[model samples]
Target: MTQQPHLFCFGLGYTALALARVLKQQGWRVTGTCRSTSNTEEARALGLEIVIFDPDHPVEGLAQRLAGVTHLLSSVPPGAAGDPVLQAHGATLAEAAPRLKWIGYLSTTGVYGDRQGGWVDEQSPLTPSGERGQRRLDAETAWLALPQPAHLFRLAGIYGPGRSVLDTIRAGKARRVLKPGQVFSRIHRDDIVQILLASFAHPNPGAAYNACDDDAADPAEVTAYACKLLNVAPPPEVPFAEAALSPMARSFYDDNKRVRNDRIKRELGVTLKYPDYRAGLTALLATESATSSSTTA
Candidate 1:
């Protein structure tokens, strides 16, 4: 009897949840770790197997849980002490590397740091500007060092479904922050899932791919587009310097670059479903409206 495909994700966050849901629908056994009991319950409600895990709270018997897991994906970000998964289960993973077909580590475009609106691809020098970016870069190195070849996905800003700017606007917190010569690369969550699925089809270990859309536009442009889709007036624009953004939110402005995703297309044979903010926001609005109609019916 042929063995079924089984995917084990290190962290069942937004992106991982999306990928796991798709794989589960296609008959793959999916299991992963969340950070909290509430998230575990919510994920289980969606027919996913999730256990709580973190740096201090490691999952017991992770090795036994991961038995027969053909594919592995880690979306956990490194903390001050480093990657929680590796810190806790590196030995087990190294021991199991021989049987695992593929391992993917979800990194960030922040590893590329600020580029002054310049473009960067997979070959770009990693010069992360902050402590968070540095942590991600370090974690990528650790994952690649494992005996099992690991694929690194440097993802740009992710938004989709209930997580996009549409939610921000509806919640009355949308803002158009203008920064001269500043641009950000963003990928819709669905596009990220497609890239992951494509990579699974074309398994190339020791490969690093930039996961983002072809369009790199300003935040203000994306916000304006989302407002247009919602049929609401765009909020007054605020200069980046005076936006009064929280320290964490303000940190996002430290990077300015157009991330090139040609590698995923050229090597993995992948195409983006929503190539730009306009298309993504439009589709999100349509989906939300359809869901609302169904609920009302």
Candidate 2:
């Protein structure tokens, strides 16, 4: 009899849980960790096998729990103290390296920081503009240093489903900040899942792939498009300098790079379902309409 595939996730957040659910439906055993008690309960409610894990509270008997895990994914971001998962369980992972078929580390395109509206592919040198990006770069280095072939996915701005410009408009919080020549790369959440699935099938260890759509568009343009889709008047354009954005939101504008995702297509033989924002947004709107109609029926 063939051995059953098992996947262990370090942080079962939005994207990780999305992947976990798909694999579970396909007969893969999925187990993972969540930091808080509420999240633990919620994941359990979703039929997930979850455990509490954080810097202060590490999972007991983690090595044993990971015994049959054929695949590993870490979606946890590195903080000032570095990667919480790596800090807590690096040794256990190294010891179990041989048995793990594939290991994936979720990184960010922020690692290529401040590209000045230039383009960057997977091979571009990592020069993060901010502390957050640097921390992720450090975590990527540590993960790649492991004996196992760790695949690194450098993702761009992730938006989909309940979290997109469409939702922003409905909440009456839409803003179109005017910053000319500044563009961002983004991927739908489902597309991100698809990339991960494709990588699982291809399994090229030690490779870094850029996970983004074909479009590198201005934020204002995206906002306008969303408004059009909803038939709402576009919000007044606020000059980027005059916009009262929180520090965290302001930080995102620091990077101006268009990421290239050719490697994923060339190597993984994967075609993105939504190749750009237009396609992604249209599909999202259609889905939302269908859901609302079905609920009312």
Best by TM-score: 2
Q: For model 1, what is the error of residue 3's alpha carbon versus the real structure, in angstroms, after optimal superposition?
A: 0.6
Ten contiguous residues minimizing lDDT sum, candidate 2: 37-46
**Cα miss at 249, model 1 (Å)?**
1.4
Q: State the lDDT of candidate 1 residue by residue for 158-255, as single tens digits.
A: 99999999999999999999999889999999999999999999998889999999899999988888888888999999998888999999999999
Clash pairs (backbone) in predicted model 2? none
Model 2: per-residue Cα lDDT over 1-297, one tens digit each: 898999889899889888887887899888899998777765676677888898889888989998888999999999899999889999999888778989999999999989899999988989999999999999999999888858999999999889999999999999999999999999989988989999999998899999999999999999999999999999999999999999999999999999999999999988999999999999999999999999999
Q: Please, what is the whole-model Cα lDDT of each candidate in the order they appear?
A: 0.91, 0.92
Query: TM-score for every candidate vs. truth?
Result: 0.97, 0.98
Candidate 2: C-alpha lDDT = 0.92
Q: After superposition, how far is residue 195 of candidate 2 from its true place, in Å?
A: 0.9
- Clash statistics: count for each candidate: 0, 0
Clashing residue pairs in candidate 1 (N, C-alpha, C atoms within 3 angstroms): none
